[model samples]
Target: MATVAGVAVEGGHWIGGERVSSPTTFDDVSPIDEKVIAEISRGGEREARAAVEAAGKAFPSWSRTSREERARLLHAIADGVEKRLDQLAIVETTDNGALLRSHLRGVMPRVAHNFRFFADWLLTLGHEDFETRGHRNHVSWDPAGVCALITPWNAPLMLATWKIAPALAAGNTVVLKPAEWTPLTASLLADITAQAGLPDGVFNVVQGYGAEAGAALVADPGVRRVSFTGSVPTARHISTAAAANLTPLSLELGGKSPLLVFADSDLDLAVDLAVEQYDNAGQVCLSAVRLLVEESVAEEFTARFVAKASALNQGDPRDLATDIGPQIHRRQFERIDGFVQRARAEGATALIGGGPNTDLGGLYYRPTLFTGVAAGSEIVNEEVFGPVLTLQTFRTEEQAVEMANSTRFGLAATLATGSEERAARVSERLVAGTVWVNCFFVRDLKAPFGGSRQSGVGREGGDWSFDFYCDLKNTVTAPWEK
Candidate 1:
């Protein structure tokens, strides 16, 4: 068997259920060792057009597929992913350096679950019919033609499935563009879907840089809907390109999500929840990057939070014991470190680590903590996208909510309080798309997930996702009296 690091994995574009070559190719380098592990086909506008055209060709028949047929195919995909979970986990760990244990336990399972969730949920869809004087109205859903799915590198396979499964389940053909930084598992997924018997041209992938393939995929007139999960800047660009053709979009963008800890709450639990920022090395868009503590317990909470954060084990992702791993790439590592240094220069005191851990090797950064982060400072406002947390204190519940709502990102937030009334009140006051009280990162497939404001545009789970991928249509019949 070929090991993840040693295998010379080579992938080309999967167009119309067949592998196609590109004139140029790029190397998939492992972030853990900064070594080339695979060679990937470099697609551009030409490839994007081919993929979109192929999806468009497939759309008519695919959209006509029965709900039961789609559901069965989705279930088959889930089973395929389950069978290959261990292999995919290792490939992802090698590709992006997310901890192997976390990838296997947390991320890869979700890849299968996403497909299963959508497959099962499709059966429960509810439609309504209306009766009027001499007329009857029936409502139905129709696939919105070809869709473009662009996913980021942080949790590539899981996030990709989050979009792909629902799109397919809703009967939309897709042209997926995985992030340039991580394409191995995505390539693997195309093969899995093929093995699962997804029809030709129904699902396609074009692997290349965002500037080349990503831009073309979104801008293509053939793509009727676009779903993207990445940075705010990239979303802005995609938003512009997509707007020209009036393509509908589902954007799951960045977050500077906040965690509020109250004096009446358990400080130890709060600390443990806040430490989740270091998960995936804080590359997650919904990671609680900001901490807002009640003034009554601010000092004590900060002390415990810093202590626990300082103790997290950071090293090789292959090690099951390693709690954290390297940042995705050298540029990301340096960008995060630059943010920390700039924050320090702006008078924010680093309560713990503030620089890269060269001793740990290969683009690793020490999990940094900061206090005295001024409101509207670069560090507090902008996403560091690393294992860094900034602390702020508020005296009143109103103040905590205000601070949490201050960022352009309204992705998600968490609060801890003893009073149920307070939890209810704070949860309502917060401007985030999802608010967690006394817990962190708790998610239900039934709950719609997305952000408000600049964080994102549309929801992506449950019926919301089903709706996003299809256009709701209504038909009316009138008696011959007219």
Candidate 2:
């Protein structure tokens, strides 16, 4: 274990309810100041295999547990998470460089909610049963056994629990391989779950890079199902590895989502949503980074949007006043800088924040807004995963929809319009899986949440989550009055 800035890091894998260490370790660097925060256990194929085997051994007993028992345990887990809310929030902010205010207010709460929601949802879950021609048919959802969950760095606990809660509630053992950059919180979560009285091997965490532990976890034949939230290219690699065993996968990949602002929209509200692209420094997959405004109000919207974005405070995430924080690491910082530089070279005009916030130093990037962006250009179509926004104009509703659906990615979209009819009509046509009308990033745990097209493969929320974590079976009976 190592300590930095009063935060202690447990640099080991949590396997079968115990801490397992590796001979080799890797430095866990904080993007806040580019300092080595901890040295984490460097898990490889062997560790991944051990974790999976532990989960496999626990599956039969866990899968056989009553739904009531599972629900009770999940509630306990949620309670445990709530108890450590402040500590978890601060640790996550330190690890990932996301604003502590945001984590404390929303992200940490949502994490606990993920467990509670799934726990209660599991209790109320009802399967389909029908009778036709005096014959009975029943549909049952059974735990699928060992589940492999690979989560990303951004919003680590929230996103990881989005998959873990449902997987556990559905009575499947989970082997989680959190992103190496932000592995601390996941390690902490393992301890929390254990304290919550979860059975050994029911939930496990392996800390390492994606290619090593992540690849091994996905490629393991013992893994009955896989849920991954990350980039599209990595999804493809996981797809290839899982294809070998014909294992089912639920992928929540990258997005170049669009936000369409109509002329009738409230100018102030529209600006607020547009500026939200910089939330968590724009690492959000569901963020509408591509701003498509009606030509009638393009000038007004762009002016207000740029103003709000430019005013965003980029500083230490622990500060309550900060709106934006550093990129996860130097590599991500360089990646964002590259995108801005290329956009500049390609003739796009930056209305605000063209480069790094050198005043703040470290990995902090300015909230950037680019106009005069060419259609189908690299900046317009690619997922920058940074605090960068690109603006474009559309002449009519048709053009707006066309521009919104133009990209290969379609994870989510935001539409702002005063007309209720137009909101309904436009939302129906958006290619993304989830469309927010007159709002941004407002989510309901019961709603089906995932992506479409290149953005992702399947949905997960409410019963949709169980569909991935469990195997469905149909039981039919012949007429009793034959």
Candidate 3:
């Protein structure tokens, strides 16, 4: 497997069914080393205008197509993604520090399933109203024209497809700007999309920074909506831009999610679930930042949790033996380390694996677990985009819920309890978009995933995602049959 730091790519921008070299360009470096893996084209203001015009042109015809017809197109896309699974996977692995064999396999299946899932969903959405039993009330769905989908670096391809696939299924033309850090996979997605015979300008990718091409795309008057997944600060900026045009927007922002362990919860099950929540070195937006444990099991849980976290081998993401890898960059590495240092100075215990892994050449951080994390510390409050979990003990279930809801982010929360009632209770009290009971990160294509508060507005995935990317138009006949 080619390491992300070493993979060589012939960089260019994919626009309107063609890989065109841009006048403007930027270098994409692997976070592992400062080596320039590829010098990708950075779309300028002209390119952004062209992309918006193309997307706008495609929207009219694409939007009016029947849902069944749209579903067929999506199915073809899914098939195309499957056929080029190996190629796409390798590209994805090289672009992002995802495991080659494991990450590739999971994502291909996911990409394939995404198309089929959305296709099935699109098929079920009809123009006729089922709710109006005797009356002649009809419903219609129109594509939000020229949607500018700005996706993040962490899960670029998957997150882009999360919007692109559904937006396409619902007949919205897309001008996608992939994150500067991970551009290859999304660029390859443009290839597969073209291969699927998706209409020209219906799907497009422009690789550039958030401040340049990304801002241009977001602020484009031609774009009717903007869907973004990244930092909260970025989302706020996008929201401001979108508001200027009064364009609809879907924002999936940051998360400092929590996992509450009730006294009745099985410690073994909780530990098992914790591994995944903090996986990818806890770079996940849904990474359980706070581990809220009841006083009874706090010490016991900490021992097991520390042991499991410490045992994880941090190395190159390409290695199958590696459970975790370095952060995306040295900057992120320093930021995470700084947070750990501040916590320790604030009198918090570095329970285990609190520092860097000296053995790794890349920017590797240990899976840190911090105890005595007071609410005031940086580690306790801020989103440390690394493998760090702040432990907080609660004497009662109510206290657990209180601390869990303390964060401004309400993206996702988990409750591990023996009794179904306790699980339901905590799940209800916890203010989050998704509450996992017993299971963690059990994401099905059918489940809606997103946040409630500062985590950002709206949901993605499931049937609701179809609605998110499109607009609704309802027609009424005054109790008269058509």
Candidate 4:
């Protein structure tokens, strides 16, 4: 078995529309193949604070921009993103493990689509006003000053855009911080914004570890809103930091999301949709990691799922044919491998793979699935955040829901059933933020996306995102002329 390894490097930062250097530098590597990709920098506290201050300075003008004008800028950003699809995809894949072709060709198109969708929504939203009493009181949309955006490296730019597009369209200035593991895409986004001719200080990026740049941004008193996507522990830390300032926050945290596959579902379609659960090598926060299948179909489903998972090509993320890729870094690879090891010690049986590919030489792990995980085991209750899925059986819908909500996390769930009414009942009752009926990761930018419990607070996407970034203030006019 070869060990997969890569360098851990600094990819710099972008603040006030300027590509700035990180105060400290590190090496970045691929977890699958152990390749050196870039020299990353540890962002400075001074820089992070400066970025937030810049965003605060820009917020007034940005918040006051006409809805039509904001939409135009967002639409222009979409156009620029469209033009750089390949480059963005390549940069995204290099910084993260997402497949180049799929992300560039598949995921990015969706991000662009999301951009246009929100841009149009921007125009539709700011025009509406809620007036109460004879004194005309109009509620107008405005930006949350100095929104602090923190992104993980898993999907890099795709997830970043999910926040950036809407925040910009909603007329908020932003200071973004990319995960230390993958700062390349965020660094490049500075150029992307430049191409879009975004105003100075409207958007910024800072690069460093969560403890440094990220922690500083969240705690900055000048920052009025904070949006973060990462692990549960990190979310908790950010929550604590934000609480000090009563800063409005949005956290799209980790999940041990469930997939309830009833016996009535088509096996073929179920298997196909199951792919998304493990796509990106099972790194997605909203991904379904705890699979609950009816015992009757468990045998068949497990067999096929194991074969497909074990057979996936694990290689360069730039390769379209490669289905699975390396882990993000050395520490993460060890963490995932350690989790699988602990699961085995706790008596869970690996039906397919639960080990690293010693052939890769550093950070790669096999896309693995575990069966026989006891209800109380780590595999059953924890967010693995790797290419590992733990599955168990249930005899009834009620049992499935109970098992689904068994974990402390509740980010999203996928209910696979033939009955629309049954799916609805389960969907309504599931403890997750987003429920997929007979599918997984089926998202529309117009919908609210977040969690129900320990998963997160508030929501992202649609007009709700606008609400998270801004508080509505009522303006009163004494029965005046129109």
Candidate 5:
């Protein structure tokens, strides 16, 4: 078996279906122990430009390929992903510090499923037709030209494929810039795409820092569309660059989402989900950072949430028993600590777990829960992006709804109530892209997913994604004279 740290990874950019070496290389250190895991080839703006040129050259043929051919290729890629699922998952775990168990059960399966879903969807999609008095109107969806896909480190391959699969399925050539924090899995994905016989330049990866490589990809004139998943600051930068050429963009940015628990809700289930908000060490964008409980049950729910959160096992990501792993890097761990300490300074009470776990070293922070958080405190409004949760109480249904929608982010929300009517009403009232009635992080690929306000700009899954990646052309023609 090829272990993540044991394997010698070639970290070069994949361009024109070939491994392109760079003049420089950077060490990819594992967040688990800060050990140099692999030496990755580092490319800069020059490399980014070359990648876009390659993708531009390949677009015409790939776009003209038959739908059946495209679907066949996508399925083959999915099969390739499945063949080495375990190894790939291990790579992701080591690179990002997600537990191996989570990769096996959740992340890895979703990566393969994304490809399959897009491929299957292509088969069912049909062109639109309309008839008029003197003419027949038909709508044809054509692939957008070159596309730039920039994915974050927390869930690299999965998020990248959320754009890649749909872009490729729509016949658009893509150049992906995986976050510098975790580039191993993205490189591995490039290898799998090659094995599956994906044509040269259809899918390319440029691995380097976001400032140089990522900006270059987004700013390239030849790239027509950009799909990015990362911080709001970065998205704003990309938006500025993309605007130069009026490039279309799909931005899935940050979130400080809320999870509301009504008095009539299932306390046990809500408590369990409250703990899970810290999943991925709380680096998730849709993490329920603000826990809103009905005033009547606030105390009880806070106690239960704190106890369950403190009980989560944190250790080496390789251990299947480890429920929480280290942060993506040391800097992020420190940033999270600053957030916690500032919250305390701002008068928030740390109910349980507020500091780093020195026992495990690396970048591990114990799951922290806070109560008595001010309405507009830093911890309540800002995205900690760590294993931290803040609690607030609401007296009425209107207050719950208002507090839940208070943040500038509108990415996702969770509401736990026994009554279906209450669930429907509250879910509708909350301003988020996806709202869970009684569950957290339950996703349906067929549904549209993205946020409003500062959280994101466009949808990413299913038909919404297909529409984003293609240009809809309407053609009207008169019947034959005969």
Candidate 6:
């Protein structure tokens, strides 16, 4: 075990309300300084099977528990998360290399909010009943046994809870297999839920590689539902494994989302939003890394964007003044650099940063912007998932929409314009799950949040979450008089 930011890291898996170790372990490295923070258990099929069994065993009693009781337990989980907010934030920042301020102010708080919101929403959830052909039909939502939640390392804890809270609220037991790169916070969350008076075996975690443990979890017949957030290739693999049992899946995969800036839009506001692409070091799936500006204002927008990006302080994530931190791992760092190199080789011009930030060292890539990017080029159409933005100019609203929808991904898009008509019309035509008018990353927990096309398979938020976590049952009754 190793200590991160004074918090003693638990290196074993949390299974059946107890800590479980494996015969082998792997190093958990921090991207910030390239340090080995902990030795995590290397679980394979054995641990995955045990976790699924535990969840399956608990499903009977847990699913039968009253909704009010489930709601109370969910609130208690939120209380536990809030109590350990500072500790969790520090550990997460140390593990993932995200700015400490972001975890403190936004990410960690949202983790607690996820539980609280789902808990309250569960109490008010309802189904419809109607009469037709002199008969009554009743619709009910029932928990769908064990849920396999495979979350990414980008925003580990927050994203895990986004799936966990709703699954539990819907009375389904969960087995969360967090990304191998950032596994600390998920272990802590398991502890938090256990402390919150959740029943034994209701929630379990198995720490290991995706190929072994993750594959085993998804392939198990007991796992009735699977929710994954990561690369498209990984989602395809998980989908294949889950297809064995015809288990339903909710996949929130990669994105090359676009930010469309109109000439009439406020230059400063548009610039600010464009700079946000570097947030979380541009690891955010919903980040509009592709900037499609109207040709009339393309030059001005590029100048302002380049200036803002240049001024961003890339340094130690622990420092409050640091605007961005390191990529999540060395491999990710290389991947980003490769994208930049290929883009340059493909004739795109680097307006500002084009490579690693050597001054600060250690996995830090400078905030980069590329102009003259061809419409169908790999750099323009593919997801870099880094602190890199590609600029393209469009002459008309139709062209902007075409450029935005050109990518195979349709996760999210941002439209910046002054005219209300343009906002409505452009947003409607843009092929994405979420379209923000003159804004970016503003999320409402109750709203439908998931991608479209290759971006994702299903939606999950509010009732949409319940729709996936629970099985819908429709019962019809004949009229008594008949």
RMSD to the true structure for each prediction, in A, is 1.7, 1.2, 2.4, 3.6, 1.4, 1.0
Which lDDT tens digits does candidate 6 get at residues 1-482? 66888998789998889899999999999998898989999999999999999999999999999999999999999999999999999999999999999999999999999999999999988876899997899988899999999999999999999999999999999999999999999999988998999999999999999999999999999999999999999998998999989999999999999999999999999999999989999999999999999999988888898888889888999998999899999999999999999999999999988999888888999999899888789899888899999998999888888889998999999989999999999988988999999989899999999999999999999999999999999999998873
Q: Candidate 5 — what's its lDDT?
A: 0.89
Write one digit per residue (lDDT tens) for candidate 2, span 189-250.
99899998999999999999999999999999999999999999999999999999999999
Candidate 5 residue 99 C-alpha distance from true site, Å:
1.0
Error of 6 at 464 (Å): 0.4
Query: Each candidate's TM vs. the true structure?
Result: 0.97, 0.98, 0.95, 0.93, 0.98, 0.99
For model 2 the local lDDT of residue 134 reads: 74
Quote model 4's TM-score: 0.93
Off by over 4 Å in 5: 1-3
Worst 10 residues of 1 by lDDT: 1-10
Candidate 6, TM-score vs. the true structure?
0.99
* Per-residue lDDT of candidate 5, residues 123-208 (tens digit): 87767688899788998779999999999999888888888999999999999988998999888888899999899999999989
Full-model lDDT for every candidate: 0.90, 0.92, 0.80, 0.80, 0.89, 0.93
Off by over 4 Å in 1: 1-3, 6-8, 479-482
Clashes of each: 0, 0, 0, 36, 0, 0
Per-residue CA lDDT of candidate 4, range 92-115, in tens? 677677787788667888767767
Model 6: how large is the Cα RMSD against the reference? 1.0
Stretches of model 6 off by over 4 angstroms after superposition: none
In the range 1-482, model 1's lDDT, one tens digit per residue, is 12465543448889999998899888888899999777789999999999999999999999999999999999999999999888899999999999999888989999999999999998888677788995888877788999999999999999999999989988999999999889988888988999999999999999999999999999999999999999899999999999999999999888999999989998888988888778999898998889898988988888787788878898999999999899999899889989998998989998888988868767988988899989999999998899999989999888888999999899999888888999998898888999988887888889999999999998978989989998988889887763
User: Residue 23 deviation, candidate 3, in Å?
Assistant: 2.2
Error of 4 at 322 (Å): 1.1
4 or 5, greater by lDDT: 5
- Model 1 TM-score? 0.97
Candidate 3 ranges with C-alpha deviation above 4 Å: 1-10, 127-135, 478-482
